[model samples]
Target: MTSTDAVPTTAPAPTEAPSSGIPDLWFELPPGFLEFDLEEDSEERMVRMADAVDPLFADATPEQKLSLVVSGEYILQTMIAGGAEHVSACLLRMSDGKLSQATLCVIIERPDVGPESQDRRGTARRTAVQWHEQHPDAEVALIMLPYGPSALCIRDQGLQLPGVLFGLDDPIPTTIRQVQFCVPLRTGPGSALFLFMTEDIEHWAEYLDVVSGIMKSVSADEPDGDSKPAADNPDAGGTESQA
Candidate 1:
């Protein structure tokens, strides 16, 4: 239940490694994006949530506070269930009480091969092809990010029930647009970062660019004192995302 700071337009600088031995991943998020760590325990998570929304609940009734806490827990659990290591959300108020939102989920994985030996272009192409197979209508492309070769996929995800997060009893279904990026990490063998962003279809283009900038800002510190931006080599051959 520690005090939380205001949401930053960019991520903070990397700190020392955690006690769990996992190195902190560094990345920036656009303005209005609030990020939550999905790896914390329930009590810690709840405390973090309370800290973030303290101003909103400062003068609210007990019942209202409970409802808000419950809704927040539900959203956290859903993200944890989906294997997200971290989640960030940007919500904009729209006319007629509607909301335009962009959500980003980060998932990290370690593979068998190291970054030096991995085939970046082939990896990017394979990822694109796999996603294309699963979503025939998706627009898949290989992109060269500052970090390295990466895959980008964009597609309409039909209707989704996001109202649950807002505590709506009978929320309307809204169409979702998704943009996913798979970028190989400089961290040893097959370490990669996956960014999955979902947004309201009406604001897909704007949000996609925001997420892309976020992706470009991602970097990791290596064990041998090397930095991600300088350690990994970027390929210039891949096509860029249309956004």
Candidate 2:
């Protein structure tokens, strides 16, 4: 395995808006948070990225192409916070000034492909195992989220923060590949997973608390007769939910 302090390069603007089912649109940014405007065609950018790395897609076996179908069809918008610069749609800093770094990446999976929640966990474990086999020196684990409903927690050995998976729809053939590649980035600290975070070992607890707040803010359903506005929802930082 190789490591580089390089940043992500920007891709051409996309022509279409990515589709998502999450209702809450607005989100409150933590202090020092930086927002990025994603160009359209996130999936296209990812395909191009894979080609750059492998280059022989046309001649690869069918299974190889399927494995490469990690990003699915839609990449969705992203909200990044912490001490780092944004590069293109899928890249970020390897490490942030010794401070913690976290990103909320929204992904859409069709109801057709992959396993459901319980099965998804098994798949995640397999992915982690494969990752370790490739990079033996790298640390990896398949843990459960501390709070919220039972969900698989994917984290690197020393990463203070781990990305969470929030599956909005039922498993379908179209969305089956969503689990193929959870994170958009193929290298660096955050890869093939959502909610990537890297921080000092001692700050792990602090980072978990911060990420929890962000997840609490996410709600796909309209605030029912009992629900409160997103901003009121501490997780959302007081922002409206977008359709």
Candidate 3:
């Protein structure tokens, strides 16, 4: 569940076109809220990366991709939503213990009509901006863990996942006592990058930064489906861990 265990395989051999979802290098400074400019030709990259995710991409049915948009939002309401329209529930790993927390949402979709859409990334960003206006009280940030990271780590690290990622084999938990939101983005000096509060903020950011970097590096190899992490990973957290 920790960063140490989430490292993806190293980069694949070079090829034509932007085969990798991540760029060649990522800086090692502030952690967590990873942001990057959207490439004009990013749709293919998005599909490629999404397609490479473990089971989701391997034998993914068209129906599943359309449904994984809000896996946990409906579940974590009272504990962590902090008054927002769209929320993401996460299992936070704090220095001491777990806590339930929620983060605002940014839903993106593909502009082009394809079974594998690329514009979903943009849809999410635009929605986030709109969400911020609707609820002036919530904190929001954009930190996209590469598809490989999201698919591989969310379950193993016990992080609560959105509907888009949940599966029938991955049954939803019936009850939950605690949750935590881990947002490692630092907006500015003394400012919260992810809008929620938690300890080890920068340290968490370091985790995201490093993870993002690694995924980006390995994104090109047409992600393989090695043995996934065991389910004992306990990947079910609440709103308390996301902002």
Candidate 4:
């Protein structure tokens, strides 16, 4: 579950687009977050990257182009924040030897809608209900964290998913616990970043604290020279096993 084991692959070939001269963003990671090296060639990686951009571009209106571009920037910055080529993830090992994971993503709202038009809490509760229905064996609850009102924190039990890039057949614990949080950027509609943490139920308080720290430490500033870069080897590593 540590960052040291990530096997990086060659960076994907950059696509040719109009050069607006806006340098790409690289977000700063909070202390103790481990970035899983996401291979560039994985199907899951491609799906995630596509998810970040595709939805924003679909059925586009002439005036929506600028919003789409800004939304894409938020998605890209979020990808960098979690140290992922496409989808970002950070794993933590708790004191009880249980594994905890945080999967990060960005969701861009449609351009025509006002940010306040949507009901975040109601939507989040419905999401929680859907997750519970998907995993009947797990306990589920909607929660509020210190990360402010725009954040959605959902606690669930017995539902363990592998890393974002790990395929369906990847070995994982038969049972798992997770806390998923979605925090909308203050930039209004077409911008929000989220993180989900999976860990043992016993470590609920601890994981909550960890996510809180992450929310507090997140920044869009460029990383320092001393900051660690994403994993660069080309090997596919196994997911961290649950203890």
Question: Using lDDT as the measure, which candidate wins?
Answer: 1
The models' CA-based lDDT, in order, is: 0.58, 0.32, 0.28, 0.40
Off by over 4 Å in 2: 1-29, 40-118, 146-192, 195-209, 215-243
Rank all candidate structures by their lDDT, best first, as comma-separated numbers.
Answer: 1, 4, 2, 3
Candidate achieving higher lDDT, 2 or 4: 4
RMSD of each: 6.8, 16.3, 17.8, 17.0
lDDT of 1 by residue, 61-146 (tens): 55444444554466557767866666765543333333344566766655655457666577778888998899999898888776
Cand. 3 TM to true fold: 0.23
Q: Could you tell which candidate, 1 or 4, scores higher by lDDT?
A: 1
Q: How displaced is residue 188 in candidate 2, in Å?
A: 28
Compared with the true structure, what per-residue lDDT tens digits does model 4 show for residues 1-243? 132222232222111112433212223344333233344434454355445434433443433333223333343445555643334444344566434444444333334676455444554466567667876665556654332233343645443334232334663443434544443222332223354434345666776665555444333222332322212222111121111
* Residue-level lDDT tens digits of model 2 in 1-243: 011322222221111113432322222233323234445365675565555434332444544433333322222222322222232222112233332233344433223332222243344456567866765655455533311111224345421111122232433222111111232110111122334343234455555554444444333233242333322222222222321
**Per-residue lDDT tens digits of candidate 3, residues 159-211?**
33333345455544332222112221111101011222222343454334334
TM-score of each: 0.66, 0.33, 0.23, 0.41
- Could you tell me which 10 consecutive residues in candidate 1 have the lowest summed lDDT? 234-243
